[model samples]
Target chain A: MSRKPVGNAPRREPIRTRWIWGVFAVLFVLLNPWYFPAGSSRLVGGVPLWAWVILAVCLALSVFLHFVCAVYWQTGDESDE
Target chain B: MNDSGVELAFAGASGITVLVAYGLLMLGVGVITWLANRGLHQSVDEYYLGGRGLGVMVLFFTFFATQYSGNTVVGYPPQAYRVGYAYLVSIPFFITIILAYLVFAPRLYTLGRRLSLVTPVDWIHHRFQSRALTTVAAILMLYALANYLLEQFVAIGQGVSGLTGGTIPYQVGVVFFIVIMVVYSWLGGMRSVAYTDTMQGIALLFGVIMLLVGSLMYFGTPGDAAAIMAANTPEKLAPPDGPGLLRWLSLLLLVGVGAAVYPHAVQRIFSARSEATLKRSFIRMAYMPFATAGVVFVVGIIGIAAFPGLDTAGSEQLVGRMASALANQSAIFYWAMVLLFGGVIAAIVSTADSVLLTFCSIVSHDLYGRFVNRDAAQSRQIMVGKLVGLVAVVVLVIIAWYPPATLYQIFVLKFELLIQVAPALMIGLYWTRMSRRATLAGMVIGAIFASALTLAGLRPLGLFNGLWGFLLNLAICVGGSLLLPPSMAEQNRARELTHV
Candidate 1:
C-alpha cells in the first residue's frame, strides 16, 4: 500500500486509490446473483445454493471493511484526543 | 399501517407495563447523564456533540440504533415474506454502508476534529464560505430529517397500539414517548441520547434473538421454508433476473451512499472522541448486519411456511401475527413478545431523538447562531434551537394525527433532495480545485431535478429517481469543476484542508 498522503489532514488515505475502489466494485458486482441461471433447481439444506453465495459475499465485504478500518484509518494526530 | 388486520395477543396490560418501564429507564439515564455532565450548557458543542467524548461502546451502539429502527423489525419481515430470499440483499446493503463510510469518513473526521464542525452544514460553510450553498444544503437536510421524524412518530403510535391492542391510544403513545424523549434530550443532549441508544440497541438485539428462537421452535427453520418455496414458489428462491439485478444494484448504491452522507451520520464522525474510537466503532458496525439483519431475514423466511396464501396486505402483518402466535404458547414467550414490542418502540424513539437533536443542532449552529442571532451566547442559541425543535415536533404530531393525502409524496421528494447533497460532500473531500460555484449549481439543479422526477413518478431507466439525480449531481460537480476552476486562494485553502 502507498504511504503517500492523498490529502493533508495529517492522515494519508491509502484507500483513496483507484485499485482499492476497483476491488470494491468487483465485490459489489459479485454480490448480485445475475450470473446464476434463473431457477437452477439447486437447493442445499433449505436455501438455494445461490443464496449462500450472496451471504458469503456479504461476509467477505464485512471482513474487508474491518481490515481497512484497522490498518488504514489512523488520523496521525492525537492533540484532539 | 396494519392493512392485514393483525392484532398481537399480549397487547393490553403486559405490553403497557413494559412500555412504561422502558420509558422510565430512558428518562432516568438522561437525568443521570445530565447531572454527570453538568457543563453541557456552556456551548453548543458540549450539548449537541456530547463534548466529543463518546467512547467506543456508546458511539457504536448509538450508530447501530440510529441506522436500524422500528421499521427494520416491524417492516422488513413483511417484505421478506413477499419476496422470499431476494430480500437477503438487505444484509449486504447494510454492510455496504460501512464501505460508503470508508470512502470519505477518514478525512472528514480529521477536518471536523481540527475545525470543530458542529453540524454537517458546518463543514459545507467552512469549506466553501458560501452562505447560499450552506443554506440550500441545510434546508434540504432539515426537511428530510423532519419528514423522517414524522414517519417515526407514525410508527411509534402504530407499534404501541398494535402491541397493546389499543389499551394505549395511538395519539397518546406518540405524545407520551415524545414527551419522555424531549425531557431526556433536554437534560443530557447527545450524551443522553447515546446512553439511551445503548439500552435501546441491547433491547432490540435481545428481543429479536428471542423472536428468532421462538420462530425456529414454532414456525420451523428457514431450510424448511425454502423447501416449501421450492415446491410451490420457486421464483422466490431463484436469483435475481436482469431487471431484479438492476433494482438490487440500485438499492445498494442508494442506501450505501445516501445513508453514509446523512447529516446525523456525518455529525457522528464529529462526535467521536478520537480517530481510534471512531475506527473501533466502525469495525464493529461492519459485522453487525449479520447479527441484526441476518437474524431478522431468517425469521422472514420462516414466515413463508407458517402462513401460506396470504395476500400482499396480509403478508405485511407476518411479524405481528408471528409474535401473537408465540405469545400464546406460554408465559415466558408472552413476556418476551411483550418486551419485543417495547424494543420496537424503543428503536423508534431512539431514532426520533437522534434526528431531533441533529435537527436542533443545525438550527442553532447554522441558522440561528450564524445568522439570526450572530452575537448571541451559545446557551441562548441552544435555547432557541430547542424551542424551535419542540415547536416542530408539535407541528409534526398534529400532522400525524391528521396526515394529508399527499404526505407520502412529500416523503419521497424530501429523500430525493437529501441524496442530491452527496456529490458536494463526498467529492469535495478529496478534490483540491472543487469550485464552489460548481458545487452550488450542482446542488441546486440536482435537488430541483430530483424533486421534479419524483413528483412525476418517473424513473427513466428502471433506476430510482434519487439515483438518477445523484448521478447528474456528480456529473455537474465534476464537469463544472473542470470547466470553471476554483480561484487560486480557494484552491490553496482546499489543498491545505484536503490532501497535499
Candidate 2:
C-alpha cells in the first residue's frame, strides 16, 4: 500500500533531474503514520508527540517545495513573452 | 447534515447588507477591468485566459481562492473533528499538490505559450491529434467542472441562507449570487475573476484566522483541548493504525493529484503573465496549506473539548456551532463571525465563477470552435460558450434546489472521473510515444471502473477508487506507450513544439 510512486515515466530527463525528487519520496513516506508506533502516545507541547512529528514533516515538505520552486525548478525561456 | 443551530443577533439585515456590498465590490472590479480592456473580448484568449497576463499576486490569490473553496472553510472542520490527529494529513496533501504540478506544469506552461493552449483538452488535441481522445478529454473535464459548479451552487445557497438566519431563503440566495457571479464573470471574464479572487481569498484567510483565534479564546488552549482528548477519546491523539494509515496515504495521493489537475487550475497556469510569475505564485501556494488547511485542523481539534457529545451527523455543523458559541462571548466576535460566513459565501462564488469560466472556455474553444465551425469568429465562439454556460447554470440550479439523494454520488464522481484525465494530460506532456489509443482506452476504462467502485461504495484495500482507477489507467497508457511505436512525424512535431 505504501510503495513509492515510480510510475512508468520516460527516462529522457527533460526537466532538470534532481535529487530533491528522491528526497520528496522519502519525506512523503515519513509524513504518513506507519513509521511511528502508536504505543509512543506521549504529549509534546500539549499536542500529541506523533502529531507534532507529522506537522514537522509537513513543514519540512513545505520548506523543500519552497526551495525547489525558487532554485531547482526552471521552466524554459520565452514563457514570459 | 442538519443546521449548526447558528442564529446570530444581527444575522438578518446586517448579513444581507454585507453580501450586497461584497457583490457590488465584485461588480466594480468587473466594470473597471472591462473598461480597461474594452476590446479584448473578441477572442477566447483575451476573454478566458485574461490575455495571458496575470502578475504574481493576482495569480497567487486566484489560485488560492479557486483551489480552497468555501467548503474548505465551512465544511472541513467537521471532518477534522471526526478524524482527530489523523486529519493532519490535510496539510501534507496540499503540499503534494505542488509536487504533482512540478511534474507537468513547467513543460506544459512552455508548450501552452508556444501553442496557445486554451483548455486542457487543447493540449490533448495538440498532443494526440485524435478526435476521439480530444473529445473524450473535453467531456471528462466538462463533466467534472459541472459537478464542481453544482457543489458550489449548493454551498452558496446554504451559506447565504445560514448567514442571513433564513431572512434570505435558500433559493433567493442562490439566484442572487448566481446572477451576480455571472454578471461579473461575463463583464470582465478572467481578469475580473482573478481580481475578485484576490479580495475573496484575503477575506477568507482573515475570517478563518479570526475564527481560529476566537475558537482558541472561547474554547480553550491546545493544551486544554489535548487534555480533553486524552481524558475522553485518547485514540484520536495517536498516530493512525494500519487501515487508517492506508487511508491517509490514499488521501495524499488522490486529493493532491486530482486538485492539481483541475481545469480552472490548469487555466490559471496558462493565465500567468510570465514563467517567473507562475513560479512565484506557485511558491506562495506551496505555503498556503498551513494557513488554510492547518488552521482549520486546529479549529476542528479545539472543537473536541468545546462540544463533546454530538454524534457524527451533528458534528457536521461544528464550524457554525463554534462561531455561534464564540458570537455569544463578545460583541466584536459576533460581527467577525458574520464576516466569516459572508466570506464563506463569497469564497463559494469565487470558486464557482472560476469553474464556470473554465467550463465556458472549454465549450467555446475546444468543443464549439474546433468541431461546430472551425472558421467561426472568436466573438461568436465566446458568445456560444456563454450561452451554454448559462444553460448549465440554470439546470444545475434546479438540481441544487431539490437535490436528489444520489447527489453525493455525483459529488464523489467529480474527482473520480477527473483523475482519469491526469494520466492522459500529464503523461502525454513528456512521453513522446504516448499513444492516443492507449490513453483513450485507459481514460474510458478507468472512468468506468472508478464510477462502478464509487457507486458500489467500495474502497478495496483502504485505497480510494480514483487512486485505483488512476493506477490502472497509468499502467495501461504508460505501458502501452512503452510498447507501441510512435509516428516519427508526430514525435518530431511534438519535440519541435516542446523542445525537450
Candidate 3:
C-alpha cells in the first residue's frame, strides 16, 4: 500500500459533472407529482399520466446514473494497495 | 377479523414445506462459506468483511438484499393499495439513494481500503479521534440496528404463520428462523450473510415476478387496474394535493439520505474487492428500482382494483389477500404463492441477519475491542461480540413478541435517528475543517429534535419528522463547522484520513 498522500492528485473531471446537480433539480421537479395534477383520464400506455411522467423521468435518471457511474465516479483505484 | 387473521387460519401445507426448504438452503450456504473460510475466522476483517474481497455479483446481490428487504415485497403493496399512484414515489426514492451515494461513497471506499477500516465507527475514530463522538455514533447505530432487527423479527413471525395458515404459530416461526440465522451467521459472518443474501435476492426477484404474473393472469395488470380505479376511485389515480406532495418530497429525501448512510450499506462499500467492483455493483443498483420496487408498485395498484373498498387498516393485508386468492385459483398459482411467501420470509431473514452481523461487528471491533481490551486477540473480540449479539437478539425477540403500537411506526422511528448521522459521515469525508464538536452537536440536536416531533405526532404540513431532523442536522453541521473551525492538529488529521 502506498503511504503517500494521493489527496491532491490531479485527475480529469468528467465534462458532465457540472450538470449533475441541474439534472437532480429537474428530477425533483418532475417527480414531485403535485405540479401535474392530472387524473386517470390522461393515460400514457395504460399508466395514469402523472405516474407515467414520474416513471419516465426515473428511468431517464437511472440511465444517467449509469453513465455517470461508468465515466465520472472515480475512486482513486490507481492508488489501491 | 382482519385479513391476516383469516389468512393465517387457512395457511397451506405446501407453503410450510417451501418455507422449510428455503430455510435449509440458507443454512447450507452458511455452512459452505464457513468451511471455506475456516482458517480466516480468527481475524476480524475476514469475518466482518470477507477480507474485503467481494466481487460485483456478491456485492450487488448483498446490496440488493440489504436495500429492498422483505418489507419491499410485503409492506409496499399495501402502501400502494392505500395511496394509489402516489406511492410510486417508492421507485424514485430508491433511485435517489444511489444518487446520495454519489456524494461520498467513492471517496470513502478509497479511504476505507487504504486504512483497512472494518466498521463505520472505525472511520469515526480515525478521523475525529474523539471518544465522545465515536461513542455517540456507535450507540446511535446500535439503537437503529436493533430497531431494524426487531421489525424483521416481527415480520418473520407474521410471514410464517400467515404463509402456513395456523399450522405454525408466530412464535414458533420466529424462533425457528432466528435460530437458523444466528447459527449460520455465527459460523460464517459476513461471507455467510452476503452469500445467503444472494440466494434471498434471487428468491425475492423470482417471487415478485411470479406474483405479478399471477395477478395479471387472474385479475389484470396495472393498466387494467388503473382503468377500473379511474372509474370507481378517481382520487387514487389523481396527482397529489399540496400536503400530499409535501409528504412525498419529505419521504423521498428522508429515504434517499437515510438509506444511503445506513451502517450496513456503508460497510458494503468498505467490503468491496476493488473500486471497479463497487462501481459496477452501484451501476446495477441504480436500475434495480425498476425490477424490484416498480413491480411491487404495480402489484399494489392492482390490489386497489382487485380488492376495492379496503380502508387503511384493511390495506395492510393486500399481499395476503391477493396471494390467498391466487393460491385458490389453480395448482400453478398455489405453488407460486407458496414460493412467494417463502421468499418473503427468507428475504426478511436475510435483512435481519445482515443487521445482526453488522451490529456484532460494531460491538466487537469498535466498543469492546477499542475500549475494553485494546490488545485482546481478534478471535476473543469476535467471541465477545457474538455473545453480546445473542443477548441483544433475545431482548429484541421479547420485545417483538409484544410489539409496540405499530411495526410501520418503528420503521419510521429508526430512519429519523439514523439520518442524523449522515451530516457527520458525509461532510467529514470531504470537508477538512468540520469540527468534531460541531459534528457531535449536530447529531445530538438532530436526534432529539426528530424524536420529539415524532413522539408529539406533529408532521408540520404532512412532512415527515425525519426531514425536519435532517434539515437541522445539515444546517447545524454547516453553520457550526464554519463558526467553529477545526484545530490545527484536527485539520491535519482530517486531511490525512480523507486523503485519497
Best by TM-score: 1
Deviating ranges (above 4 Å) for candidate 3: A2-16, A38-41, A78-81, B1-10, B404-412
Candidate that scores best on lDDT:
1
lDDT-sorted candidate list, best first: 1, 2, 3
- Can you give the lDDT of residue B296 in candidate 3? 94
Q: Candidate 1 lDDT, tens digit per residue, A1-81?
A: 113333464554646556777878889999988888876758888778898999999988888888878776665644444
Task: Kindly report which residue pairs in candidate 2 clash with one another.
Answer: none
Q: Model 2: per-residue lDDT, tens digit, B1-500? A: 12445555557888899999998899899989999999767978899999989999999999999999998887788888887888888888888998889888877887788788888989989888899998998998999899999989999998888777788999999999999899989999999999999999988998899999998888986778778878888888888898898999999999889999999999999898877798889889988999999999899888888988678877877887888878778888888887888889989999999999999999999999999999989999999999999999999999999988865786657889999999878878767778888899899989889999999989899899999899999888888777885788878876676564
Clash count for each candidate, listed in order shown: 7, 0, 2
Instruction: Indicate the TM-score of model 2.
Output: 0.95
DockQ list for all candidates = 0.46, 0.33, 0.50
Summarize candidate 1's per-residue lDDT along B142-247 as a digit string, tens digits: 9999998999999999888888888898999999999999999999999999999999999999989999999999989888897888878988988878788888
TM-score of chain B of each: 0.98, 0.97, 0.96
How much does each candidate deviate at the interface, measured as C-alpha RMSD after superposition? 4.4, 6.9, 3.1
lDDT of each: 0.87, 0.86, 0.85
Of the candidates shown, which would achieve the greatest DockQ relative to the real structure? 3
TM-score (chain A only) of candidate 1: 0.73
Clashing pairs in 3: B11-B164, B11-B165
Question: B306-381, model 3: which lDDT tens digit per residue?
Answer: 8888888788888888888888888887777777888889899999999999999999999999998999999999
Off by over 4 Å in 2: A1-15, A78-81, B1-5, B406-408
